[model samples]
Target: MTYPPDPYQPPDPYRPSDPYRPLDPYQAVQPPPPDPTPSYPPPYTPTSPAPSSGSGYPPPPPYGGGPAYGPPPGYPPPAKSPFGPPGYGASYGPQNTSAMAIASLVCSIAGVVTCISAPVGVVLGHLAKRQIRETGEGGEGLATAGLWVGYILTVIGVVTALFYAAIFIWAIAEGTNVTTTF
Candidate 1:
């Protein structure tokens, strides 16, 4: 059986007799009562002079007197801009397309219908690129696309022409009779 704590000797520091008791001696002491009267700072007062009954300065005008400073009466309002707001000025409107670039794209499309147009498309595309660099006109992408399509089609056309020419030359050399087949 556990024995009760010694009444005469001091309690052991490592193991307390009562676990709920506070460690600090001052924890159980009560605080002092507050004073009866509370203190506060003095009230504020402005130093500027008040307006007198007979002063020389006139009274301020009524609130709705147009604006303090702006355009005079009967003046026209600002004109609205078509491009954007009033500050943008004349740099608006649709940009001009490069004429040579449009021509290059058209010729490249025509090359699909006729093989002779491929070379013309290539020439026009090169001229368009030069003009676009100098004058800042639009359609640089159109010119580049036309050049690529024209080159690819031109290679195909040349190979097809060579193949047909070889077939005709071989038929002539083989001594085949041509009158009955037609």
Candidate 2:
């Protein structure tokens, strides 16, 4: 004996002739017939080389040997600069500081803190002043200040080191001359 169809059972796609088969909503709604005219762009055709202008100057060679006048087909336009078009005059004043002068000041300040870079500061200061004289950059006062600070610090460091060395030698000499008796 054949069993009756269950109400909750899903319809089978293979059994199309079944009396209880569910109708497909998509089958009734066929796709609209294709339009007679297509919306595609026109076919591309290569053009001949561009004629040079009558001004006597030769036309510039095409970039990458692709096109003679404009960019190759399907390419986007060139991007614009964020700073606007070229040929605009300075928007701000001359704020360019000398790199060597800045370095000299930094080294001098560091030497003041660590007590070792004083000589480097002096050398850089002299170089910075020479560069400023030639290039006419700013920061001349900073270079001079760095030079004075470095010189003073270097002399103090040397004198302090010598004074300590002399005291150490004196202590050693005194110790050797002393006699210890049991």
Candidate 3:
């Protein structure tokens, strides 16, 4: 009886017994050895004389020194503005002014003009102040002025109302005759 075919047998006679053999026949051609000397041009050499040690400028630190300012060699210097200093345009933009601050000032001024509106002005001023504190808004001076004006007017209004009520109570208590005539 014939034995079972060997599973590990090579299919082709030309296949190598060694597993590491190159698959391509051209891979057997050896590459040329590396040249003893490099073919690139020589590095740049400065022609100018070195700065004198006695010069006022401090000597540059050795290579690998900490960070330095200005552009590195072979790079052009940064452009400068002719109008102003280095940071001329750094803060360019209109400053943001708070709307509540303006409203508070207007309300306070109106309260002073028309005493009846003192309470409204006081309320607006307080709200504006609170908002200003919560948000870093401008116009703090306006808000402060509004608060002062509104408070003063409110006090005056309260005092005047109390005085009128007291006078009416006193008049009635004095037993004055009351008559209605058309």
Q: Summarize candidate 1's per-residue lDDT along 1-182 as a digit string, tens digits.
A: 34454443344554434677646754453444553444332222345344354464434445785666654444444566777755744556777888888888889889989888987988999999999999888899999988988888888889999999999899897766555664
Candidate order (lDDT): 2, 1, 3
- Cα lDDT of candidate 3 equals 0.67
TM-score of 2: 0.48
Error of 1 at 67 (Å): 3.3
Best by lDDT: 2
Candidate 2 stretches with Cα past 4 Å from truth are: 1-92
* Model 1 TM-score on a 0 to 1 scale: 0.48
lDDT (CA) per prediction = 0.73, 0.75, 0.67
Q: What residue runs in model 1 are displaced by over 4 Å at the alpha carbon?
A: 1-92, 176-182
Instruction: Compose the digit string of candidate 3's lDDT tens values, residues 1-182.
Output: 23443333324444554657846765553444555554434333456444468564445546865348875544456767887675754655665667776777788778767876666666777777788788766777777787788888889878988999999999997757767679
* Count of backbone clashes, every candidate in sequence: 0, 0, 0
